[model samples]
Target: MPRTRIHNMNISLDGYAAGEHVTFDAPIGGAERLFDWFDGRVIHGVDRVDAPVTLDRAVISLWSQGIGVEIMGRRKFGPQTGEWPDDGWRGWWGDEPPFHTPVFVMSHYPHPSIDFPNGTSFHFVDAPPHEVLRLAQEAADGRDVRIGGGPSTVRQFLQADLIDFMHLVIVPITLGRGVSLWEGLAGIEDRFTVETVTSPSGLTHQFWNKNGHD
Candidate 1:
């Protein structure tokens, strides 16, 4: 069965996922250290030169596997807010985005969809989490739908109990003040079968699968 999943969600030890402020200059804000161990090439199943296959890379490589569509908040798409300005901002990604599938960007302000040559299409939508998931699932065409988040988006899906699988990377650091992933998500582990694997690089990868889900 098709599933709703989240992949490569990095969070601080204090449960913060992103930094306090996101701007066009600093997209990740103050939480840049959280992704120190990340290698974007591995998401496409590629390893670094002269580097052996590590556990962290092996796990992170699973990010784009079988993912047909993605649902993400507006912040994850760009630094714009409210009504989008005519900046011609496609996204943080350049001409080609890593997600070579339909991407539904959640925003209250509607805008025409943007398509890239690499098969990464960005569709703007204004709806609740569940409603957006429905649209994403339909666009998925039987493949899994990935929740591409910046903490707030993932928290909304988790609160609505709409996520089926998640790959959460917990980094050992404290942001002190930033966007948190676990806020108001008390006892969320009870709904999923949780497992953890600690890498030698000090990154703990937590896999959460909803109960009765494969």
Candidate 2:
């Protein structure tokens, strides 16, 4: 059975996964600074190449390692709101979208599925986490499903107790306000065994895995 996982999500010290005031210019919200730990490595989904095999690179590489389908909030897909303006907006990812698998964008408004030149195809759905997961799993064909998120989406899955594994990088900074991952997840740690490793870049990599599973 394929698992539901979250990989390489950067969080602020105050537990914000995304900053406030998200716009086309600022994708990750005000928490854009949280990703300074990239260290010039080639982003796996976007660049599709590895830098040296350092911890940052090693962990970043896993973002695309074994995932088949991706389920993300509409905000993660883009900064669009209301009805989609036009077909012109494919995504923030340009022609060669990084995700080579089927990607599901959870949205309130409906839109026809968009397939890019690359292997990525975006399907817009207005469904809850479990229903969305079922659809993604069917499309994945037994491969794992990744929850590519904007905090709110991830929190929904967490609240549903549906995530099997999660990799969160806690950058050493604080965002006073934003969408937080831990806001309503009071005892989320009890769902998985927590392990911590500090990267050379001062980011703490926290792995949350279910007991007796990877």
Candidate 3:
């Protein structure tokens, strides 16, 4: 069976995954400081110019590995809500999205499926996590399905016990307020074999694997 996975999810030292207010102006809230560990050039898709390969770059690069389909909440798809304001708003990524495979956006209000030129497509659906996971798994065609998140979505899947693997990056900053990833997930660590690794950039990487899986 193909596994469901989450990778490179960054959280603040205080456990907030995003900031209090999220708008087009502040897509990730004020938690941009949490990503300072990554080399700016690598994240922005700039070609490397002799920069040493650091832990941050290595970890960020692992995002697309073994992922054939992605599922995300509507918030992660965009900053819009309640009957999308415009159809022209594709997503935060312009022209070409990073995910080349199908991405299912979880929304209460469904819209026509969107197909982009760069092999990235968006399908809007109102199904619950399990149903959406089934659809994503089918689209994945045996490859792993990635739960690309904005805190709330990941929390829902974690609550449903559907995630098979996860890589969480704990940044050394505190947002104080925002959606938290561990809000109601008490004792979630008991279900997985957790391992912690600290990078030279001061970020701590937490790996969680389902108890029975390798």
Say which candidate scores most in lDDT: 1
lDDT of 3: 0.85
Residues 1-214 of candidate 2: C-alpha lDDT, one tens digit per residue: 6989998888988889898777889988867887776753335643455445677777777888678999999998888789988857888887888888899999989899999777899999998999999999999988999999989999999999999999999989888888889988998798799999998878899888977674
C-alpha positional error of residue 84 in candidate 1 after TM-score superposition, expressed in Å: 0.4
lDDT tens readout by residue for model 1, 98-163: 899999999999899999999999999999999999999999999999998989999999999999
Candidate 1 wrongly placed segments (more than 4 Å): 40-42, 46-50
Quote the lDDT for 134 in model 3. Answer: 92
Candidate 2 ranges beyond 4 A from true positions? 39-42, 45-51, 212-214
Per-residue lDDT tens digits for candidate 3, residues 89-200, read 8988888788888999999997889898888999999999999999999999999999999889999999999999999999988777888999999999999999999998
The candidate with the higher lDDT, 1 or 2, is 1
- How does each model score on TM-score? 0.95, 0.93, 0.93
Q: Against the true structure, whose TM-score is highest? A: 1
Which run of 10 residues does model 1 get worst, by summed lDDT? 41-50
